[model samples]
Target: MSMTSILLTILGIAIFVVGLLFSIAWHELGHLSTAKLFGIRVPQYMVGFGPTIWSRKKGDTEYGIKAIPAGGYIRMIGMFPPGADGRVEARSTSPWRSMIEDARSAAFEELEEGDEKRLFYTRKPWKRVIVMFAGPFMNLILAVAIFLGVAMTFGFQTQTTDVAGVQKCVISQSEKRETCKESDPVSPAQAAGLKVGDKIVAFNGQKIDEWSVLSDRIRDTIGPATITVQRDGQEKTLHAVLKKNAVLKKDSDGEVIPGKYVSAGYLGFAAQTEIVPLSFGDSVVRMGDMIENGVDSIIALPSKIPALWDAAFSDGERAADSPVGVVGAARIGGEVMNLDVPAQNQVAMMLFVLATFNLSLFLFNMLPLLPLDGGHIAGALWEALRRNVARIFKRPDPGPFDVAKLMPVAYVVAGVFICFTLLVLVADVVNPVKIS
Candidate 1:
């Protein structure tokens, strides 16, 4: 690769890493801030996952970095399995006393009884839930901020759905001209009996304003179809058969809404539109709408996971599009950067994709399961309810989340996550998603 190409490639990967870290840190910070606000003890605030790279005690919390770049988290005392054995001195101790200080010294403290310091359970259940949910909410806010910042800096382009022009191959000429004037009579469009300046009236009887509509219709139709067009003030029917293009990587949107893929087609055409900038208010609203749509789509994606996963893994023509890892993201990013459009515009498109990626992270973590934010939320909620019901029955309050009972589930979840990551890595290695 050329120096500039190498630079862009490195730059893309670097930006992606930085972006993921920034996004993840901001998410964890939200949880930390809320927990502190509610007077809950957060013993550790770490960025990244896995083993700690660096750590130090800072007042009530230990701040550190972990080896895993996937995400970051805050460890609050009471938030884990609710029934930790540490009890407040039943005899009488000031609520103002630090729970961490006491837990450090108390040898008899049980894991299920709540710890006074840094324990998440001592705080109100509602507060605990808020802390867990805040991470995803923070992510949504970050996306909005990034989108708005980009929009404000460069007026958002107003892309039209209209076909202003078309791309057709032609021989280079010596004379300047306003439009294509072909001397050759046997070009593809000409051989297909298509003429320059021909206005496309319809494809498969569907009205075509933009090339995208025609492209999509043609892909769906697949075979020779009657294409009606107005050329030289005459309506002509061209028997056109759409050719199949390579199946590229599938997009996440396809998992939510059926039939979301946009395959390549050699229609021998290109088009451009008048760029328009969105108003600041409109841009903000549009960004919000994007988030809303993202949430709804994520909620609906589970039903299609079986089909989507099948497509992703099956060793068939469609499997060619299944990308497995960070390499795939880089390959795709490089291709996007090399689009015929402006580089800044390409970056903007990448940012939009990143926004969707962030949105997926938010929604996926919100599902109630072990290890994810949603899982913690579910665990906390269940603990709170159990405690409340026990209080109503005039019985002893149950302990925090039972680690012994949950260990099996945790192992299962961890195994699945690892397997999926490995599968994706393999797929990325073997069938890396690259753009042409």
Candidate 2:
């Protein structure tokens, strides 16, 4: 790499790190602000983890930045309910019981004269749920805002009806080559005199305004068909008998899968594409697709671990869609910056990367597992359900749920996360994904 390229890479990584810190701060801000609003005492609001880089005490809350840029948190008082005896439970011989008590003790360690009423667990279940939900909600809001901003301003890359290239002859997709041989049969489009730059307006009397629509119709039509094209300010219809030929198969997402071919009706022209601005409705549809794909990707994560492990430790090729960690994302950010594109396009791509990260955070943290924001929200909701049931049955209220009792489970979850993070880091260093 050249000196300029290396320097640009460093700058991009730095920019991404800064954006990450800001996102963490934004997430914690949601927790901190909501806790304060609900009369809960927030003793600390820290972005990142490990040793503090800078801190300032204001009112009762100590705000600070930490060394690590991975994650952040807000220390809300009484996050867990007391034991059967109180926050101070009787000593238990079972290791699991001990783990539960230790968690409860830590929650109330900073007890002060007026802190009793300001405890988080003292709040109503609904309020507690809101507090826990706020952090992920903030990330969701940021993701949506960023997506909408980019979609409305920069637009999307889309294929148009204009023909970009015309094939000289039919080449089977199984051949895996774009070059045409002299012995190959003439393509239907070439035989019909379809030329480059012709804007397709209709197919078999059906109006065609979109390339996808035209592509589908062509794929389904086997025999003779009329193709209407708007060329040189005039509309003209061309006739040809479409041939059944082998073509590369595309996934549900319209992306061609490599080395996968199927026999289909063939057209012999490539559609041109441009970055076109989309309407609000179109943007919403785009977001919906992105979100659906994102969810599917997350759900399929466990299945990809073996591939990820092989890529990190062996000569296995790393799949392009493998899960990425902080290090991997930072490297991708650098790659994006070094892309040979317009400055504004680079900025738009960076924003999109950040937005996608935020969206992932929102989705991941909403899982009903301990230590994540979603876990706490689930606890509060369960508590609400129990109390409501009691009210209906004329039984004594169950009071606040003892979230601390799940400390052991949370610890296990955190350990797994840390191990996964380390594995990802190693993979990122050894066999990182490249955009090119």
Candidate 3:
């Protein structure tokens, strides 16, 4: 492969990792900060999984870096199963009290003493809910800011007619025989009553110097369009609809399938596009709308996950057109980087995808299943409610997080996520989505 291609691939992978790490860290920070604000005793703040490679003591919390790069966690006292590491137990006055003071107990055991430091459990219901929800909220805000900044800096690409002194339309030359045929269709020409033989033209009541000028006008006008072209010996104005056409892709077997989409007006003919400048305010508004749409789409994805998985694994026509994994996302990022557009535009497009991605993660993590953010949120909420109900009856809080009760479901959910990730990885490699 060429050096440029290699460079792009490497860059894409690096960017993907950086973005993922940053996003994950930001998410955990949300939880850490909120827990601290509530006066909860968080002894260990870790990024990623596996063994700790480095650590630093910061007040009551021991912040550390881990060996694994997948995900991170916050170690709040009295939460989860008792650790044999003696981090909490050794510090306790009595062995029995140490067992009771374990990290996991924070979620289940009602505080008999030291209630002041365990403020997460003591806070009002709304405060607790907000803390649980803050992580996803931070992600959403990050997405919006990234998108808006990228848009303002680069603006958006549109298939409009704002021509430069470049080849918009060129006469095809033949070397073999004396004759050559035009394979590309002219949508605008046909719509404007220009025949196969008619070539010279003026557009939008202005003299057309090149095809670029014509392209600019069409892009600027996406709704109703009017084109003035020379036909035979006279000029005429033809009313047309400038609806964006979907660019189709073919699979390895040469079958057309839905793929990366672009906005191109269908004037009943095929033509190249030109770049058009957008106002800063307009770009920002578009970016905001895009972020809103992304959030809406993410909120709707979970209900569709089962169907999507079925389509990918079953004998359905749409099975091949499934979601992608890390490899696929990197490939896509590389392709976007290779585009003949400004860096800002490229970043904007990537940010758009990332926004939707983060939003998807935010919603997905909220599901009340094992190993996901949603599971933790659900566990916390359930414990809170259970305690409140027991208090009304004048009973004591529950004792511990029953691993047996939760393990079965957690194992199943973890299996499903792993399987899905592998399946999507295979699909991404086999049927990579190519942007036209």
Candidate 4:
């Protein structure tokens, strides 16, 4: 890569890291604000992990930035209550028992005389659930707002029926030749006097509104047909006999697969694309589609691990749809900055990448696994359910579901996540995804 390209890539990565820090801080802010609003004592609100890089005390909370910029947290006092005998400190012979007690003791390490009423566990179960749920919900709200704003303002690239260019001759897509050869036959579109900028109005007497529908219709039909076009403020009809030719089939990313070819009706014209703003409902519908795709990507992540390993170690071609880590995403952002498109287009694409990242954060954190916000929410809900059932049956109250007991399981989950992250990191460095 050129020096300029390298510089642009570094700049893009820096901007993305900044965006990530802000996102982590924003998520923690949600928890801090809600906890304070509910009269809970939040001692510290720190973004990132490890040693404190910057901090300042404001009111009752000490806000700080940490050295490691991976993730963030807000410390809520009394996250778990003491044992049944009201004992905060206890000794155990078993290692697992010690782990549970250690976690419970840490929860009340800073307990003060007046802090009992302000404890997080003292709040109603529903309120505790909301407090825990607020963090990921904030991310979800931000993702939606960013998506809607970008769609309404910068808009999205949409293909239209207007002709952008006409091929000079009918060349098989598999051949991939730009210039016409000596024996190359004239394209049907050229022979029919079709010009660039002509808007396709109808195909074979059928009114066509969407470019996708028109393209599919043309590809399906190989015989002679009347095509109506709006040219120079006048509607005109042209008759042409489309030829059945070998064309390379493309995947979702619009890249031609090597062995994928289909005999489709060829009209040899490229459809024009324009940035068109969407209505609020349309934008929302598009957002739903993105959410669905994100969920599918997460579900299929494990299946991609083998492929990722191969791409990183063996001589394997990284699939275009391979899962990308932070490093890969940063590289893509750099490529986007250096792309030969309008500046506004670049800004829109960057916004899109950030929005998608936030959406993924929201989804990933909501998984009901320990060490995640969703896991805490699940614990609170289960506690509520257990308490209500006991009350109905006139049984003794089980003070709280000891989430601290699950620390061992949480450690296992954290280990798995760390391993997966490292795998992705290696794959990204070795066989990073490239945009063309």
Top candidate by lDDT: 2
Off-target runs (Cα >4 Å) in candidate 1 are 50-57, 81-115, 151-162, 165-275, 279-327, 334-341, 384-404
Count of clashing residue pairs in every prediction: 32, 1, 22, 0
The window of 10 residues in a row where model 1 has the poorest summed lDDT is 169-178
Task: Spell out the clash pairs found in candidate 4.
Answer: none
Span of ten consecutive residues with least summed lDDT in model 3: 167-176
Query: Which order, best to worst by TM-score?
Result: 2, 4, 1, 3
Q: How many angstroms is residue 61 displaced in model 2 relative to the true structure, after the best TM-score fit?
A: 0.7
Off by over 4 Å in 2: 181-183, 248-262
The TM-scores, one per candidate, come to: 0.62, 0.95, 0.62, 0.88
Candidate with maximal TM-score = 2
After TM-score superposition, the amount by which residue 202's alpha carbon in candidate 2 deviates from its true location, in angstroms, is: 1.4
Model 3 lDDT tens row, 330-385: 77777877777677667766776676567655766676776665665676677677
Per residue, candidate 2 scores C-alpha lDDT tens digits across 1-436 of 9998999899889988998988889898889899999999999999999999999999999999999999999998888888877636558899988888888888887889999899999999889888988998899888888998899899878999999999889998798698888899999999999999899999999999998788888889899999999999999999988999988788887767787988889979999999887888888888888888789888998898889899999998988888898898899889988999889888888888899898899889998999999899899999999999999999998888888888999999999888888888999999998775
What lDDT tens digits, residue by residue, belong to model 4 across residues 1-436?
A: 8999888888888888887888889899889999999999988999989999999999888999999778899999888877767887689898877877887888776777899899888888999989988999889988999999999988898899999999989999888779999898889899888999999999999999888788778889898988999999999999988999898776664435676899999988888999999999989988988998899888999998899889998887888888887888888888888998988888888888889888988999988888899888999999999999999999999878878878888888999999998888888898888887
lDDT of 1 at 273: 49
Tens digits of per-residue lDDT for model 1 on 1-436?
Answer: 7888777767776677677777788888999999888877677788898899899997778888888777787776544332235443233264323333343333223333344554565566677789889999888777776677667666554423333544344332222232555652222334455555566777777777755466566546644666677766787877665444432323433222233334443343433445455678978777877777767765654453443355456753323323334556655666576567787777776786566557667877887876678876887788789989999998897756442235446557878777766666655555555654
Positional deviation of residue 329's Cα in model 4 after best superposition, in angstroms: 2.5
Model 3 TM-score, all chains together: 0.62
Model 2 superposed RMSD (Cα)? 1.8
Return the number of clashes found in candidate 2.
1
Instruction: Tell me the whole-model lDDT of each prediction, alpha carbons only.
Output: 0.62, 0.89, 0.59, 0.88
